[model samples]
Target: MHRGVREFIRWVEAHRDDAEIQLNPPATTSDIAALEQMLGGPIPADLRFVLTRFNGGVLPAGELLPAGIEPGTIGHTVREYAEAVGGDFLDTELLLPFHKTPEGSLLAFDRSAGPVSDTWPVVDYYQDLDEHRLMYRTFDGWCRVCVAEWTSDDFGADFTLETYLRSGQRHAEVEPDVATAHATVAHALKRSGRPADSLAAYLQAARCVPPLPWCDWEALKIAAILDDEASAREAATRLASYAPAARWAQRETSPGRVAEVLGPIVRRSGDPKPLLRLLEQLKAQADEEEGPVVEAILEALHAGKDLPPVRPLREQSVVPHVPDVDAWWEASQAAYAEGRLRDDDLLLDPDMVRLGRLRPFAELLHIRRGF
Candidate 1:
């Protein structure tokens, strides 16, 4: 057996006491042979070893699909998913699905990568987007991540703020240039009740390439809460510069949206003139609806009155197309209330909260996926 496979099994055995994890009996040799015949090729040696020992069952992060079609083996689903994909995104014949993630995606082996099945890479097939995302270079590589995730209680009931923070740091170390990792770390710190550290992390994220406006927005809020005037000013300035290009700015309510954030800063600064100048510049380039909103802010500034209150902004989920997320959140809340889960684990389970897995690599850096 491969080292990664051995390590994974050891970890699974170590945590076998957890009620949420289940390891079925090993696959019979004949069943394994039948599976290979069905695939029209030999299986990866490491995978065959895993099947021989544990067959397939549930893990915290995802389900290990069994071989030989015992209700959850994904026999026809593979071909159906491939057929749905239709395009040149994948080679239908060589795709062998082995795992099903909580997000309803399949982790499949792309057998066309090389002659040896062991060298084939694993790819995550997203049903919603009809896309295949390369997840690991080899089956063992995926096992390595699984071992790490399971060993550290990632996606497990014991998940905590520290777990999230450590995961974020690991991702940042792997992809230093990706702003999302730093942002995830910042959010984790915020949840840990460390506003100062969170603000610093957000600032660090904002300095990354293509500087995320969400990072600046969050930093601005934290600075305000921390009563750090210098940091607040810096965040506000960046937000102002990004206002024109902001997605929400294109709407008719753009001016009010801008005012909601900028107004508070202006009020706090006790200098409305600078904001007025910025509004005037925006007005020159603004559309008809946008001009009126800018004018409203200017009117309030000139009269030294409070800016009109706009609807409070709500932070939206970075995860997309998960319609039943509210139910997931309610479950987390119930679990936390019942003492079955930690406060941090309430909404950070990679198995429960869809955003949990994406945060480290993608979600936190952008308002929406693929943006």
Candidate 2:
């Protein structure tokens, strides 16, 4: 195998037990030949090298398509896409599919680049937009980017205040215009009990050109928490007065959600009149789905009943934990490593694969076989 591909294999193997890193066994010589025959072209040298050592599987960046003309294989998918779109973009000679985005868009090698396959650039084909854009100049370049993404400090890990801080700093430095990143940091800070810092971050997000409404929404919540009447009024005015054309604004600045967040604050102040008036103004722009929710909030206010607590952004996990799955996973992995448990054996044990740590592998297999 090529040295770079070998190093990637090593890194993946090191993380084999991780639920996120699913990889398949290497392809045989015949498998490579079959894929080449199906495509009627040579596979790029670097990609071919990697496939011989580790036939495509799920990666942190996306699903790497395995080689073959079989269902779910790279060649088969390329042909299928070409037929659907009626374009030369997915033509086997013009481009070769290698990966699929999380949304199922194809990323392929641009064979039109040159005679040499290894120098072919990678293009991200947006299925929805019917557009393709060059992403990387070479297969190795794409691989390096994927590796860097996975190796990043917070990759595949739950967010922590420290991670959020690091991410906030990086996003503020690298992509200062992205309001969502700033808002993420603000949320993390708010959750960590740093209202002042959180408010600052939210303000920064709101300062972005064409600012996101959610930033202002968050600022209002923080201002209410701090009892900063002026700041609260400013944020509330922004949320209630401005009209946003984007579809996302409907959900982001939903009056019902805003009311819930401000419920306790208004109750504490012994005045629901101001908030009720604000919601009434926002109700004009609320969609069908949101109008009812806002109406419910208004009814509760009129009845002098305490509003429910703010619903969390993400629902808490309700999946029951399996008993000693950790210990079973260790033993299962050990058995597999010793060849006591084959891939076929693991496949048959659907519960173990689905409920246990082998979920990633099962998903990969399902994709590969088009199950």
The lDDT of each candidate is: 0.63, 0.64
What would the per-residue lDDT of candidate 2 be over residues 130-175, giving only the tens digit for each residue? Answer: 7565555556656654555466778777756666666655545444
Highest TM-score against the true fold, candidate: 1
C-alpha root-mean-square deviation, candidate 2: 16.3
lDDT of 1: 0.63
Residues 1-371 of candidate 1 have per-residue lDDT tens digits of 77777998888778778888898899897777766665666778998888887888898768988777434664445556556767332343557888999889889987767778877777778878765645665677677667666655455555566887887776565445556668888888766656678888888877876445567767765665455666766665555553454443322234344454455556667555666565565566556756676677677877878666443223332222254766554554444334453322213223533433232211222211110
Itemize residue pairs with steric clashes in candidate 2.
Answer: none
Candidate 2 ranges beyond 4 A from true positions: 1-4, 88-92, 157-371
Model 1, residue 362: C-alpha shift (Å): 29
TM-score of each: 0.47, 0.43
CA displacement after TM-score superposition, residue 196 of candidate 1 (Å): 2.3
Backbone clashes in candidate 1 total 0
